[model samples]
Target: MAEETRTASRARAVALIADVVRWAGIIAAVILVIHVILVAGEANPANGIARTIHNLADALSLGFKDLFNKPADDPKLRTLINYGLAALFWLVVSSVAARLIRRLA
Candidate 1:
């Protein structure tokens, strides 16, 4: 009876982990698709991906600085910061998702 209980508990734990991992995959995929779309729209297809990202960071930084120098509380500035933070958050989440996917797979 004890052995059976242990086995059952282990199985349940695995199932829980699997469910979490599956959801992580779905979320990660969605994030990746969104990032690709945004990058595609902002970057020319002829540009290298690395260079594009670099250029974007530069442009965003400059814009952010310009906004900061102004009212310092502009809605557009807040929106840009929010988007940048959200993008970075999603990247970290996706990395964690990859780890979970690997473990569950």
Candidate 2:
């Protein structure tokens, strides 16, 4: 019985960790998406909220900054593609990681 209790607790803990990973991925995706919207809409760069989101998105872009360097004339399109791909990457990686983490139980 004691061993069974330990195993159940371990499973629960793993499940919790997996959930955290999944949520984190979802959050990253949301941030990237928001940044894309802000840039495309030409939101005021001076605004504190906009600036913060832009910084976060820049960091999360995962070196996709230039990405192909196409569409140089349209900054909005560039941001949408690069940041959008980064967001999708995080979502996929996090989901796979969560699944692998759950398997540890």
Clashing pairs in 2: none
Question: What tens digits encode model 1's per-residue C-alpha lDDT throughout 1-105?
Answer: 999999788877866776675565455444434444545456554667646644454443333323334436553444345445544554566567656655664
Model 2 TM-score?
A: 0.95
lDDT of 1 at 83: 42
Off by over 4 Å in 2: none
Backbone collision count in every prediction? 0, 0
Please write out the lDDT profile of model 2 over residues 1-105, one tens digit for every residue: 999999899989999999999999999999999999999999999999999999998888888766857788988998899999999998999999999999865
Model 2 poorest ten-residue lDDT run: 61-70
